[model samples]
Target: MRDTLDNLYTLDTLATFTPGVFYQFLMTKTQQFRFVKLGERFSSICGLPVAALLHDASLLFNCMTAEQRDELICDILHSSQHLTEFYGCIALTKPDGKQIWLEARSSPEAMPDGDIVWTGFVYDVTAREQALAQLAKSSELSRTILDNMLDSVVSINEQGIVIYANQTALSLFGYQAEELVGKNVSCLMGAHHASQHDQYLQHYANTKEQRIIGSNRVVQAKHKDNSLIPVELRICELDNAHGRSYLGVMRDLSHKLMQQQAIDQLTLQDALTALPNRTALNRRINQCIDNLALNPTQYCLICLDADDFKLINEGYGFEHGDEFLRQCARVLSDFGLYFLARTGEDEFAVLLETSEGRPSLEQQLGLIVQALAKPQQVFGDLISCNFTAGAFCFSTADFTYSDVVRSAELALHYAKSGGKGRIAFYDHRLDQHQRQHALLDQYLRTPDILSQFYLVYQPQYDVAGHLLGFEALMRWRHQEQAIAPDVFIPLAERNGAIFMLGKWLLQQACQFIRQAQKIPALAHCRVSLNISARQFASAHFTDEVLTEIRRSGITHSLLHLELTERLLLENPKDVVAKMQLLNRCGITFSLDDFGTGYSSLAYLKQLPLHELKIDKSFVRDLPVNSSDRSIVSAILLMAGGLDLEVIAEGVETELHRQSLQQLGCRRFQGYLYGQPMRAEHWLQH
Candidate 1:
C-alpha cells in the first residue's frame, strides 16, 4: 500500500508539469522530499505505479541553473489564475543559456485533496518563434524596396486584372490606389488597345510569349485625361508561392521624344539659309532616286549658282550677302514646282518631277530665270542679281538620277562660263568642254597669260566715210595660242583676274586717246572702251576710271564707257543713278547690245546715255530679214526722238553700211570699215 501510494503521488503530481522543469525543480530541492514513499503515494493517486515512472533529477540540474529552476516553479505556481484552469501545468526554464518556453496539459481526474495529476504533454516553441521572426523581416524588406522604386511597377493576373500597384504606378496612371485595385489593366490603356486587347492576349497565349517581357519596348499608354502617352515598358513574369503574375515597369518618353525631334531638325537644316542643308538634301534625293528606280519616269535636276556671288559678299559685306542668299531662297521657293535646298554657301539645288517622256525642261528653266530676275532691296540699297542654272533630264535608259545631277552641275559650270544668268541644258559635248574649261581656269591664273593681254582699236566711221573714234577691244596673245576676248574675258571674270585686266585696259585706252588727241587730224575724236559688267559692278569702278582720266591729262568727255543693256538691267535704278553721277563728272555712256533685253522702254529712257548700239544679231541679218529691218528702223526712230546717237554694230557688208547710213544712223562699226587693228596701226590709219 505504501509503495502504491508513493507511486500514485509521484506519477500524478509530477506528470502535470513539464518533466524537464519538474525534474530540475526536484533536483534543486532534493533535501525537501524523501523520494520513494511520496513518489509511490503520488503515482497511486495519479493511477500509475511509482515503479512505472522514471526521474533523472541530477541530469535535469546539469541542463539548467538553480535560478532558472526557481523562476520556472514561481511562474508555474503564480500562473494558477489562468494556466491552471485550462492546463494542468505550464512551465518555463533556461536551457542552453536561453529561455526555454514550454507548455503542458494534464488529464482532468485530479481531486481537491493533495492528489497527483497525470496525462500531460510538453513541446518546445523556440524553432517556431525563430521561423516567424525571419518571415516578418523578409516581408518588411520587400515592402520597403517596392515603395521606393522610381519606375512604375504594376502586377496583373492572367485575366488582365490589376492585383497590385505601387505608388509610382498609381500616380503615373493618375489613379488612386483604391480606385485601381480591382480595375482591369485595359482601363488605363484606353480604347486604342481595348478593341484589340483580346486578340493580343490570344496571340500571347498561343505563343506562350510576350514581346516586352525582360526587354525594353516602346508602347503607347493612356492617362487619366484619356490622352495617349508614349512610354518605354519593361515587363517580367513572376512565379511565387501565391501564383503566376506579370510585372510591368513603365517610363514616360514624351519629353525624350520631343528632344530627339529637336535634335533631328537641327542636324538636317542649313544654318545660313534656313533650308535643308546638303546632308538632308542628299538623303531626300537618294530616296526619290530609289523610288524612281522602281517606277522609271523622267525627272529633272536643276543646279543653280549665284553669279559673282563672292564679289558681292566681299565688296558689300557678309550681312548684305546673307540677305542676298535669303532673298534667293525666297524667290526659288515661289516657283512651286520643285523643292529647293542650299547645297553650298552660294549654290542651291532643285528637284522636279516631270511628266513621263516630256522634254519640256526648257520652260521650267525659263520660269526659274524669270523668277530670279526680280529686283531685291538690301541694306538700304536696291541690288539686282541673277543665277546661272543647269538642268538635266533623265529620259533615256542610260541616264540615272546621279548622272542627271552630275550633268546638271557640269551644265551649270558651262552656263557660268558662257555668261552668268543663262541656262544650259546637259549635252555630251558640253561635258568635255566643261572639263577643258576647268583645266584652263586652273592654268590661266599665271601672270604670263595675264600680262600678255592687249587691246586692239577698231575704227568707227560716220555716214560721210569720215572716222569718228576708235573703239578699244581686248585680246589675249598667249605664249602658245591666241586666246580670244570671248574666251579669256569670261574666264578672267570668273577667276577674279578681270579687275586687274580692266585696270590695265583703262590705262592703255586713256594713254592712246591722249596721244590721239595730240594728232592734228584726230583732234576732236573720242575713244570708247568696252567695260564688262563685272568691272562696272566693282566698288571702286567710278574712282578708278576717274583717276585714269585725270592721269591721262585728257578731257573726260573724250573717254566713253560702253556697257551692255543687260548690265544696266541688273539694278536699273541703281545703275541709272551711278551713271548719272559719273556723267555729272564729264564721263559719257553708251547702251551696248540694244533690243536684246526685256527692260521696258520707260526703263531705258531713264538711263543716262549718249549712244545706242544696235546688237550684232540685228545688224548681221539686216539685209535679209524684214523683221530685222523693221526693228532697226524702229530703234533708229526711237533714238532720234531721244536725241541719242545710233551706232550700227557688225556692219560687215556694203549693203548693211549703205542701208544703215540711209536709215539716219550717224555711227557705223564693223569689218566693213576695217577689222580691229593694233593700237600703232590705228594711229597711222
Candidate 2:
C-alpha cells in the first residue's frame, strides 16, 4: 500500500510539471459524465483547479464556448457506445477572456460497469493552428494566379508524376486540368523522349546532377492529337512538403520558328530564279568545310555560266532572259548534283560531292554540259543554250569556303576566255596561269602598250648557209620584264587587242623589208611574219596586208606570211580566199608548225601555200628516234609531191642538219644557224 501511494505521488509530480493538461475521465452506463483524474496544470491551461476539474469535469467545459460544450458531450457519448478514440480541436475562451485553440486526442476503454473511460491530453496549439490557416489562404491565392498566367505552368513530383497543372498548361497540352493531375509527365512527350524521361529522372535522383533543370530548353511536346508542338521550357527545382518536385514554365515556340524559317528562306534564296542564291551557296560551302575535318571527302565546285547569254538578253527581252535562266536552273536541277545555286545574273554554281573520283565527275559534268545544250523552252521559243563550266576539286581540310569558290570561279574564267562551251579544271598551275593572265590583261589595256612591243629577226638560211630570209618574231618588255610571243599573243587575240598589235607588226615588218631593199644582197631575202587566227579571220586582213606592202614601197614578193595548220581547221573557204588575195599581190604563204596540228591533206592541197615549216617536235630527236625520222621523211615526201618548199626547224646540231639534208630538205631555221636577235643587231651582224 505504501509503494502504491509512492507511484501515485510520482504520477502527480509528472503531470503537474508537464505542458498543457493531462486527464482521465469516464461516461457511466447511465450516461453521466464524471472526472477520473486531472493534472495540476489543468487550472493553469483551462483556468480551473485540478481538484475542481476532478470533482466535476463539467467545469472544464465552462472554458469552452456553448458549441464546444455540446460537441464534447456528444463525443463522450459516442466514445462510450463505440469505445473508439476521441479526438477534437476546439476554440476556447478562458475565464480571463483570453482566446486560444485546444487540441485533444484520447483512447477510450469499456469498463466492467459498462462505462467508457478515456485517457488523453489536451494542448494549447494556437500558434501552429494560425500558421496552417494562413498557409491555406496563401496556397489558394497562388493557385489562382498560376491558372490565369499566359505561360503554361506545371508541377511534377520527383517521380515525374503530374501533381499540379495550371489552366494554361492544360490548354496548351490539349487536356483538362483534372485529366493531367495524376498522369505521368511523359504522356505529354513523344515516344523517344518519353522512353528516356524516366531514366533522366532516375539519374537526377541518384546523382543530383542537373541536365535540364534551371535552364530553358527548346523541346518538342506532343499534343493530345499526337501532333508535335515546339515549346520553350524552363524547369525549376522546388522543395515542398512532398520532397523534391519540379515546376516547369513553358511558352509555345511554333509560330516564332515558322516566322524565322520564312525570313531565312528569303535571305538564302534568289528571288527571280527561285534557286538558292550566293548567300545560301556560301553557307553550304562553309558547312562542307566544317564537315571536311570529321569526314574526309572530295568536293568539286563547278562555276558555270550560260554561254552567249547576253545574246539571249539582246535577241529576246530581259523578261525572256530571266525565263531562260529559270529554265536553265531547272535543267541543271534535273542533272541531280549535290547542290545548285544562282551565283550571278546568267551564272550558276554547282557543288558536287566527288566520291566517284575526277574522271567520273568529269564525265557527269560533260553530260550536264551536253544536256544543257539541248534546246529549252523560254516564252514559247525553243532557244538552245550552252554552258561553259570551270571546276575545282579538293579533299584537303585546309581550304576555306572562299578559297574553293574563288578557285572554281578562276577555272570558269579560264574556260570562258579560252573559248565558250567547254569545261576547265583548276590546278596549281592554272592558279599561277590566272595570276599571270590578270597582270598581262592589266598591262595590255594600257594606252602606250604598243610602244612597249618590238620585233626580233630569226634568220632563215639555205643549204649553202646563205640567208634566204628572216622570220620576224614579236616580243614585249614591260619595264624590264620580257613577255614571250606564245604568252602575250594569245591573251591579246582573245581580248581584241590583237587587231592593234597585228597592225603594228605588219607596219614594222614592211619597214624592215624596205630597209633590206636598200642592200643589194639582202633585197631578195623574204621577211616572214606569223598570222594569228584572229588576225587572219578579220574581214580587213587582205586589204591591210596590201596597204602595208604598198606603203613600205618594197618588193611585195619579199614578204612571206606564216600560217598555222589551226587556221585550216575552220572556214577553209575563207582561209583560201584570204590567202589567194594576198598571193595574187606577190606575197607568199608558209604553213607554220605543219605536222603538229590538224594536218589535212584535203585543206592543204586547196591552199595557195609556198612553204611548209616542220615543227621542232618532229625534228628534235633527229636520227635517234626512228619514228620521228619516219615522220620527217613522210612530211618531206608529201611536201615534194605538192611542189611545196620544206624548212626543217629546231636544227641545233650537225647531225640534225645532215639528217634533214638526207631527207631532201634544202632550207632550215634553227639555233644552229643563229638565235633570234633585235633588228639592229641582225643588221649590224
Candidate 3:
C-alpha cells in the first residue's frame, strides 16, 4: 500500500486514487493515523500559504519497492527549499527525464538522519506553459499593427509637447524615436512662424479648436540638420484615455516651389539672349517711371533707328541679321548707366538720368553719338551703318515719361528726315513740320507722283564750246507745287520707294539716250544719269538698269552712270567691284562731287572711271577762292596723270568755265551753257 501511494504521487495520479482504498489503508494500519496540519510554509508553486499537516497521521508498515521510495525521496530533495519552508509538496524532473513528488509534514523538521521532509501535493506544469504561449501571440499582433501604419503617428500633449512617436513620424523629422520624444513641437516651426505659433496655440487652447486638424495647411518645419523645410501639415486630434493629443502628418513642398520658380523665370526672360523680354521690360519701365516721379529731375529719353538696316537683312539673309542684332546689343550695353532696350526691329531706346540743373546734356548727347558712330563688323563685313537719334528731356515744367518717349520718337523721325546719322532734340515746331512731311511722303508713293516725275537735261560742252552730252536730272512736278530732288529723294529712300523711282529715272534716261541718238548734233554725245546711294544698295538695281537699257535698244557705252563720292566711300570695295563689272560690260562711271569726300589719290587710281566731276561747291567760287583754285588745279593735274577725263559741274559763270578750261578741264555742264531743260527743248535749241 505504501509503495502504491508513492507510485500514485510520482505519476501525478492523485485524482485517480479511490477514497475506499484510502479507508482500507487507514483501517489496516497498525500505528495511529490522523490528518496532519496543512503544509505551513508559503507555496512557491501555487502562491498559497502552506497548511499544517493533520495530527495523528496514519503510518503503514507495508513494504514498498525501492524504486518507488527512491522516487519519493528524490522529489522531496528536489523540492526541499519550498518544502522545508513549510510549503506544499513540489516536484521536479531530473536530467534523465524522471518525474518525482513529495508528501510530508507542512513544517518539516530535521530528523536524526540529517534530512528534511515536507507534506504537500504535486501536479504537472504543461497546461500553464500552454497558457503563456497564447498570451505571447496576442502581444506580437498588437506590435505589428502599430509599426506598419502609414500616417506619421506623432503623439503630443495639449501643450504641444511630443511624447510618443512611431517609425513614420521619426523618419519624417529625420530623427530617431528616442530623440523626438521629449522635444517641443514648436521647435520644428520655422522662425517665420515662431511669433504667430503661440497665438495659434492660445486660440486653439481657448476655443478647444484646431485649425489644421484633419485638413492640410502649409507650414514650415526644421529638419534634424537645422534646415528649414516647407511642408503641408495635417493634424488630427486623438481622443485617447491619456487626455487630448494631436497627430501630425507632414508632406514636403520643396519640389513644387522649385518647379514654379523655373516656370516663372522662363516666362519672364528671352530664351535666345536671356534678356528680359517685352513683358518684363514694360514692367521695369513702369516701375522706373514711378520712382522717377518722386524726384522730378531731368531725365532724358533717346530713340535710335539704324539707317539702311533693311539693306543688311536683304544682303545677308535673316539669320545673319539676327546675329547682327545680338552683336549690336552687346556693343550697345557698353554705354554706362543707361537703360537700353530694343524697342523695335532695328530701333532701341535709352533712358538717361541727369544731375539736377546740369547743362551737360549736349555733351552727353555728343558722347552718345560718338558711341553709335563706331563701326561694327558683322559676318566678315565691315559695316559702318549710322543711326539717327531723337532725344527728349523730362522737366516738371513739361512732360511725363510717356510724353517724353513720344516726343523723342518724333524727334528721331525728324533726324532721319533731315538726313541720317544726325540727332534731333524735341521741338514743337519740328514735330509739327515732321507730321506734314510724313503726309507728303505718303502721297509721293502714289502713281500720280510717279507719272509726274520728269527729267531735265543739262547740256555739257567741251572746252571748244561744242556740245558733248547732257546730264539727266530728276525733278518732281507735284500737282500743287514743284518739289526739289534733295527733299523727295530722301523721302523716297526712307519709304523704300526709291527702288521703283530709280528704275523709272533709268528708263527715262534710256529714252533720252535714244532721242539724243536721233538728234544729229547730240547723237555722238554720251548721256550720264546720277544714281542715288539707295539705288546702289538695292539688290535688284543692276538688273533693273540692264533691263531698261535692253528695252531702249541703246548701246551700253552711250549711257554713263554717275555716282557721288559719298556713295563710294560708304562701301568702297563693293562700289569698286560693281563699277569694274559695269566698265567691263562697256559702261562708263563718273565720280561725281569728287572733291567733297575724303578723296585719296590711291583710291582714285584704283577706281574704274572715265570722268571726275568737280563738285559745284568748289566750282561756284572757283576763280575767287584760292582753296577752290588749288583743288581744281590739283584735280585736273591728277586726272591728266591717270588719263581720266574731267568734267566741271555747276558752271554758272563764264569765268568759272574759263578758269576750269585754263586748268585743262575739257568737259563742263552748268547754267553757263544752258540750264537743265526738257529733251524737246534741247532738240529745239
Candidate 4:
C-alpha cells in the first residue's frame, strides 16, 4: 500500500526531477498520473503532441480518458498489502484521431531523495480491436436473412421485452430500431390483445402450451400511432445461448381485403347502371322476409312493364331500347325505392317499404305512373314510358316469398288484359281471370272448337237497291256465351291460332260462292272476307286462296279479300306485289277501314285495290255531323283522284245512306241494307 500511494505522485514533484533523455516521467506518492514514457508510439496513443509532452509531462497525464485513468487508480488503491503493481487496458485519442486501445502497466520507483515516480509500460492494442470487428462482419449472412424477409421479424426476450427487430418489423409498425428495442412486445398489439399478452406468456412459460408456437393466425396489429391493422401472424420458438426468446413473422392484409371488395362489387352489380343485379335482388328479397319477424313492416312487391315496348323496340333499334332502360333506371333510382332492378327485357321490379307515415302503396304507385306520363326524350325521339304496373301487398302473414311475387305477376297480366296503361292491385277476382286464360288455352288447342266456328254474311247494296255482294264475318259461338269477335280474334292471333282460322274462313267463303252459284240471284255476286294482318303476311296466303277457289270450282273474281289500310302500308312493296298477283288471277282486294288508318294519298294509287270502305265510325253520324261530312267529302275526293271505289258501312239509317250517296259513295253495307245472316237465309232473301 505504501508503494501504491508513492506511485500516485503529483505533477509538481515530477517537475522538480531533471528531464530525462531516457523514455520516463515521474509521479509522487499520490494517485495522480504523469506520463513518463517519451517514446513516439506511447505519446501518440496517450493523445498528446511530442512537444506538449516534453514541455510538461502532466499534459499526457491529463490527456488520458477519465474512465481509463480512474480505473487505473482504483486498481492500485484497492490492491492487497505490499502490492503496488497494476496492469489493465485503457483507451485514448491523439488530437482528433481514432481511438486506440492500450495495454498499460506502472510500478513504483523510489528515489534516494525520498521522492518517487512510476515506471510505466504502455502499448497500442488497435490490432486486437480490428480482429474483433472482422469477426462480427463474418456473421453478416444472419442479418441479410432477416432484412430480405417479406414478413416482419421480431424477437422478444423471456421477460416479454423486445430485444431485436429487423428492418421489415420497423417498417411494418412504423418505428425505428431504438424506439422499439427494450419496449414490451405487447406495445405492438391492440389494447384488448395487449391486456392478455402477459398472461399468455406466463401460461406458455409454466404449462408449455405450444398452441401459438408453430401455427399461423390472423390477428390485428397496432401501428406506432396506435391504429389497428389486420395482419397474418406466425411465431416460432427460438432457443439460443443467451436465453429463451420468441421470433414472429407478420404479413399485412389491407390490400388483399380491398381487392376482394372490388371483385364483389363487380359480381353483384349491373354492368350498365350499377344497380344490384338479379342475383343480388333475389338475395335481398330473402333478407327482407327475414326482417319481417321483428318489425310490422308492410312491404309490397311490384311488377311493372312498358306497354307496347315491342313496337318501340322494332321502330327504333334495340340499342335505343337499351338506352331507354338505362334512363329508366336513373329515374327510378331517384325515387329512393327500397330496391329496384331491371327484371326483364323491358320490365322492372321494385320493392317498397310501406311503413306508417309514408305514402300509401297505391299513392306511391300512382306517383310512379304520373312520372312515367312525362315523355322520356332519348336520341331526339320523345318517348313516353306508358308503363303498366301491378302490385301485390304483403305483411307478416305471407308464408312464402315467391308466392307473393307470383301473385303480383298475375295482377300485371290482368292489368294488361283489362286494356293496359293502368295499374292493377291483386284481388281475388284476378284468380278467375287466370283461370279463364288457362281455359282459353285449352279450348284453342282442342280440335272440337272448329265445329262451332261458322261464317255469316252482311250484304252490300248500291243506292238503287241492287245487291252487289256480301261481307263474310267469322264468329265463334262458345258453349256459354257468344264471344265478341274483337275478344276471340286477338286471342287467336296471340296464340298462333289465326293461321288455321284464316284458311278455314277462305274455304267457307269459296264454298258459299259455289253454293250461291246454284241460285241465279246470287251467282255473280262478290264475297268480301276480312283478312288478319298475320294471315295476310303469310307466304301461303295466295296459294290458300287459289286452292280454295279450285276446290269449290267458283270463279276467283267472286272472292274479294278485305284488308286494312295500315296492313297495306306495312311492307307496301310486298303487299302491293301480292295483291297485284291475285288481282291478275281474277281475285280483288278491298281496303277496309280506309280513313281510320294511314290514309295518305301517296300510297292510294300504288295498291291494287278494287274498293275503299269508309270506316263505320264515320258512317255512324252522317249528315248532322258536318265534321263527318267534311271527312267523307275529303275521302271521296281523294278516292276520286285515285280512282278507288268508295263504299260506306254501318249505314243504320236511310239518312246515313242518303248522306253517303251525296258524298259520292255508291255502295253501302250495314243493318240498313241487311243484318249478318246464314248463307241459307241470304239465299232465301
Candidate 5:
C-alpha cells in the first residue's frame, strides 16, 4: 500500500487527490475499503451517490458485541476526545456477516462545516495472518522451528532417498518412520511428478541450476490411504561436505483450498436458494449458443416469475421473503434435467431441451404451473407461488443468447399482465419492450409527474341498485399519452420513487374520503384504496397510513384497505395486528382479487375482513363459461361460510350480473353500472 501510495503521489498531495483512483490499488489487494466524513449525513462517499450509499450502522454493525468491532465503531463514530487519529489492526465484520482481520488507519480532520473528515485505508489481513501462521511449516530454519510446525517435514539424501521423516510426515503419509528411512522421497508426491523427480535431480546436478529446489508450490501428494491431497511444498537445497541433500517442508492446504473454492462459488451461485445466479445462468446460455453451431439442438428459454411476489417480502419481512424463495427454488429444481437459474428477485429462467420427441413447451409449462400453483407453507403461513412464464423457442436463426433471453423476458411481462398463471410466447415478430424501460425510468424522475398522475373511481353497487362506494385506481399521463399501471409502477418501485408516490396516493385517497363525507349521497359510502406490497412492507407503513388518515381528518368509517390474498399471507400476525389497530378507528379491510391467489382456511378466520372481491377474470365469462361459474360458486360458498360479503368485479353484461346475483354475490363493479371516471365526473353523475 505504501509502495502504491508513493508511486501515485506524495503524502502532501493526498488531500487533493480523490480516493477513487486509489481504490484500484485496494481492489488488487482486498475489497474491504471505506471512508467517511463526520456528519456523513447528506453526503456521498467512495464514489457512491447519497441515495446508493449504505448507512454506517448497516455496513458495519449496530448490535455488535465483539470487543474489536465495538472499539473500531467507537473510534470512528463516538470517540470521546476529538478522534484525531487511530492506526492499528482490528477485526471487521463485513456486511455479509463475515468476520475478517483488517489492517486499517484513519485520520480525522475537523472541517469548517462542523464536520470531521475521517480518511482511512482498509485491507483484509486474513490471508496474511494465515500465511504467517504457515511460515513455521514453510521454512528451513532450526529443528525447534521444524518441531513447532503443523505441516509435515522430510530430509532427502543425494540419491533422492529419505534420510529423516518427522512425526507429522509419518502421520500425514501413513508410513512408519523406520519403514520410510531408506524409501525414495518420490513416494510422497503422486506418480505424475514422482516419475520425473530422479531425472530432474540428475539434470540439476549436471547443470547446477535450480528450478523448484528453493521455491514454494502446490502439488498433488499421495497420502497413506492412497488418496490424493493438495499440499504446499517448500524446498531448501543443501550442499555439505560429501553430497547434496534437500530439506523439504509440506503443508496440507486441503482445508484452505476448499475454503477458496467455496468463496469462488459465491460469484455465480445464489446464496439464498443455492441455485445458479444470473451470471452463471448467462454463461450457461452462452455455452449452449456456442454448442449450437455443432449440435444444432432445439432449446427454449422460459423466464417465469411469481406473481405479486414483492408483496410477500414487503408484507412479512425480508426473512420470510427469503424462505419463500427457497421453497420456489426447491420446486423449480425438482423438474427433470433442466438448467434453472434465478434471474431476479421473483424471476427465474429455465433452459429446457425441447427436441422433437420431448414434451411440448406448453405441456412443460402446464406441469410447472400445476406443481407450483399449490399453496406453500412458509413460517406457518400459507402462501401461494404461482408462475407466469414467458417462453422463447430458439433455433438456428437466433445468433446470440441475449436475443432469445431478451425475447423471453418480454414475453414474461405479457404473461404477468395477461392474467395469473398464464403463459406468453415471444417469437421474432414481437417488438421487445426493453428499450422503454430506461425512458420510463427517466420520465418517472421528472418534476410535476405527481400532477400528471390522477385517480379514477369505479363505482360499486349493491343488489337493490344502491350506491355502496368506489375503488380508487391510479393513472399516469405522460405528455397526453396514457401509460398503463403495469409499465410505470414497476419503474417507480425500482428507482425508489415509489415511496414518494405511495405517500402521495395515500394522502389523496384519504383526502378524497374525508371530503366525500360532506356529500349526502356518499356520506355513508365506503371508498376502497389499493396498497402496493412495497409500500406496505416498509418499516413504518402502518404508522404512515394512520398519520395520513389523521392528517386528512377522515374520521368516518368510509375508508377500506384492499389487498390481495398473497399479501395477507405475509406476516399474518403483523397484518392482523395492524388491521385490528385501525379497525378500532372505523377503517375496514377487504381481501381484493380473491380466487386468483393463495388463500387458506386458517388465515381467513384470523383476519378482520369485511368483504371479498372476486377478480374480473372469474367474472368475465360467468354466463357462458361453466368453469368460471364453478369457481365463482366455490368462492361464494367459502365467503358465505365465513359470513363475508362477496363482490364481483367486471360484470359487463346484464347476464353477468344476473349470474353473479344467482350465485349469491351481493355487490358488483363493472361497465354495467359505471366505467371508471375522474372524481368530479363521477361525483356529477
Candidate 6:
C-alpha cells in the first residue's frame, strides 16, 4: 500500500509539470459522463478548477460554445460506441478574456462493466494556428502586388511552361489566366524565336551562359489574334526550392513606335504642299549617287522656280498664293517624274533618270516647261504657272549631294538673269562664274576689304562745261587686276559685308569733301555717294549717316546720297520718312538710274528728292536712237515739272551735249566733259 501511494504521488507530480493536461474520461451505458482523473493544468487552459471537473466532467466543455459542445459530445459518443480513438480541436475565451485554442486526442476502450473510458492529452495550439494564418495573409498580399503592376509579369518553370501569370500578363498577351497557366511560354513568341527557345534554355543549363538574362530587348510578341505586337522584354533567372524558373517583365512599345514614325514623316515632308522637302530630296539624290556605282546610269537634277509667284501673294493674298503653289505641285506630280521635292518658297527640285533612251532630255524638258506654263485658275483668277528650270546631268558619282544641288541652282540663277520663263542647262562658263563668285565672296569676308578698294570721282558739269560736284565711284584692285562694280557689289550685298563697306564709303567720301574745301573749284561742291537697297533699309541708317556727317565736321548740304529705283520697292513709307528726315537736315537726295526699274510718278512725288539722273542706257545712243531721245526728252520735261535737276550719264561727244542742251538738259556727265579720275587729279583739274 505504501508503494502504491508513492507511485500515485510521483505520477501526479509528473502530470503537474508536463506541458499538457493528462485526463481520464468515462461514459456509462446509461449516458452519464464523468472525469475519473484530471490534471491541475486543465484549470489553467479552460479557466476552471480540476476539482469541479472531477465532480462533473461536463464542466470541462463549459468554456466551448453550444456548437462546439455538441460536436465534442458526438465525438465522445462515436469513440465510446466504436472503441476507437477520439480527436477534437476547439476555441474558447476565459472569464478574463484570454482566448486560446485547445487540441485533445485520446484512445477509447470498452470496460466489462458496460462503461466507456478515454485516456487523453490536451494541448494549447494557439501559436501554431496564428503562424499559419499570418503566412496565408502574406501570400495574399504578395499576389495583390503582382496583379496590380503596370508591367506584365510571368513566371515559367525549367521546362519553359508557364506556372504563374499576373493580371497584366494575361491582358497583355490577350489570354485568360487559366488558358496561359500550363502552356509553353513559346506560344506567345514569334515562330523564329519560338523554335529557338528550348535551345536557349538547354544551352543555358549546360554552359551556365547568360545569353539574354538580366538584359532588355525589343522583340515581337504573338497576340491571341495571331498579329504581332512590339514589346520591350526583360528577363531574369530565379533560383528557389521549386527548382529553376524564369521571370519576364514586358512593356508595350506599340504606341511609342507609332508616335516616332509620325515624327519621322513630318521630318521629311513639307507641311504646306504635302511634298517631300529639301532633306528628303537630298536623301534621294544620295541614293541615286550610291546606285550609280552598280548601274552607271546618267541622272539629271532639275531645279525649278515659279516665275512671278510673289505677284500672287501681293495681288490676292498669301492664302491664294499657297493654293497656287499647291496647284503647281499637283501639276508637277502628274508628270510622273522620278522624284520631286519642294526645296524652298516657290522652288521645286526633280531627280530624273536620263538613261531611259526615249524622247531625249530636251524633249522631256520642253514638255515639262509647256505643262508648267499653262495658266491655272486660282481663287477665281487665271494665274500663269510659268516656271524657269535649270538642269545638270551626270553619269558618275564624283559630286556630293550638295554639290549637285548647287550646280543646278547656279544654272537657275543664270536662267533668271538671262530672262525669266526659260530653261538653262549647266555649262563650263557657269562653273567658272561660280568659282569666281566664291573667290570674290572670300575676299569680301576679309577684315581689310575696305583697304583694297578706293574711290574715283566723275565730274558733273553744266552744258557750257562748268563743274558742278563729282560722283564717287568705288574701285577695287586685287593683284593689280580691277574687279567690276557689278561683280563684287552684288556679292558684298549677299554676304552682309555691305554694312561695313557702306560705313567705310561714307567716312571716306565725307573726309574727301571736307578736304576739298581748300580748292576754289570745289570749295562748295557736293560729293554724291550711291547707297544700296540693303544699306538704305537699315533701321539705323539715319543715325549712321548723321553720326558720320557730324564726325567729319562737314556741312550736311555738301553731302548728296544717290539712291537707285530699287530702294523705293521696299516699305515706301519708311523710305519716305527717312528721306524726309535727311532732307530736313539739309542732305540732298537723287534718284540714280531712273527709268530703268519699276518706279513711277507716285514714288517720285512721294519721296523727298532734289535730282534725277538719266541712266546711261537712255543716253549712250544720244542723238542717234529716236527712242533714247524720246525717253530723255520725256524725263527732262517731267523733272522740270517736278522742280528737280537732271544729270545725263554716258555723254562722249559734242552731238550728245548739243542734243541734251537742246532738250533743256543743264547737267552733263561722261567722257565728253570729264571722265572718272583720282581725287588728287580732279583737285588739280
- The per-candidate count of clashes, in order, stands at 21, 1, 25, 4, 1, 0
> Which candidate has the highest lDDT of all?
6
TM-score for each predicted model, relative to the true structure: 0.47, 0.53, 0.49, 0.56, 0.48, 0.59
User: What is the Cα-based lDDT of residue 330 in candidate 1?
Assistant: 86
Report the lDDT tens digits of candidate 4 across residue range 1-685.
2322333232223323322112344544554445544555444455567667766765544557788667766765543112244455566565676766665544443332333444444445554444334323542225555666555778788888998877888998999999999999999998888999989999999999897987768899999998888987777676656767777767665643543343334334565566765445545666777788787787788888988888878888877777887888888888999899766677778888776432477788888877866778889998776889988777784545556667888889888987777888889788886777667766877787788788999999987899999999998877866767877787787788889899989888888899898888988899999999889898888888888898899988999989987677677877888899999999988889888876567777787888888999998887789899999999898888888888999999988988888878898999988899988897775
What Cα-based lDDT does every candidate model obtain? Answer: 0.69, 0.81, 0.66, 0.74, 0.72, 0.82
RMSD, candidate 5, Å: 16.0
Better of 1 and 4 by lDDT: 4
- Cα lDDT tens digits for candidate 5, 1-685: 2333342243223323322111111110122323332222212222223333332323343323478665765665542133334444555544456655545544443322334443444444454344334443543335554555466778898789998877777888899988888989888879889999998789888997888976777899998677998897878776555566887878676654543343235335666687877656666776777778788777788888888888888888887988888888898888874699887788788988768432467887888877877888999998886789888877674556657777888888777777888988885445636566678898888777798899988899999999999898899988889999978887887887788888888887777777778888887777888877777777788889788877788764778889878777877877788788778877888899998888898889888888899999998888999999999999999988898998998989999999999988899999999999888885553
Give a tens-digit lDDT track for model 6, residues 307-336: 988888998899888888898899889999
Q: Candidate 4, 586: how far from true, in Å?
A: 2.0
Pairs of residues clashing in candidate 4: 6-29, 8-30, 9-28, 25-36
* Candidate 2's TM-score: 0.53
Q: Determine which window of 10 residues in candidate 1 has minimal summed lDDT.
A: 20-29
Tell me how far candidate 2 lies from the true structure as C-alpha RMSD in angstroms.
33.7
Model 6 lowest lDDT segment of ten: 132-141
Tens-digit lDDT track of model 1 for 488-528: 77787899888888899999999998888878878777888
Choose 4 or 5, whichever is better by TM-score: 4
lDDT of 2 by residue, 1-685 (tens): 3433444345455445444355567788888787876666666766767787778867767778798789878877776554455777788787788877776756565443466666665667565345335434443226665766556778888889999887878888899877888999999888999999999999999998999987768899989888998997878776656477777777676644543344344445677777887767866887888789899988889998888889988998888988888888898898888999998888899998878877898898999899888987877998987899999988878987769988998888878877879898997888888788889988898889999998999888999999999999899998899988888988998888899998999999999889888877788889999998999999999989888888889888998999988887778889988889888988899999988887789778888999999999988898799999898899999998999999988988889999999989999999999998888886654
Instruction: Go through the candidates in order and give the C-alpha RMSD of each one to the true structure.
Output: 35.1, 33.7, 37.9, 33.4, 16.0, 31.4
- Tens digits of per-residue lDDT for model 3 on 1-685? 3433443343223223311101110111122233322322213322332332232221111122456546644544543322222222234343345433332222232222334322332333333223223323432212244345433445578777887666755776788877888887777778767657667767887897756666767777887888888876767666545666666655455643543343334333444344444334444445556666676656677788888989878988876776676766776777764577666677767777776343477667667667766777777876666878898776453443446666888889878877988888889897677776787799877876687778889988888888888898888877668888878888888887887888888888888888878878778878888888989976666777777789899889989999887787788888888888778878898988888788778887899999998889989888889999999999989889999999988999989988988877888889989989887897664
Q: Which stretches of candidate 4 lie over 4 Å from their true place?
A: 1-268, 282-298, 306-324, 355-388, 394-396, 399-403, 410-431, 621-630, 653-664
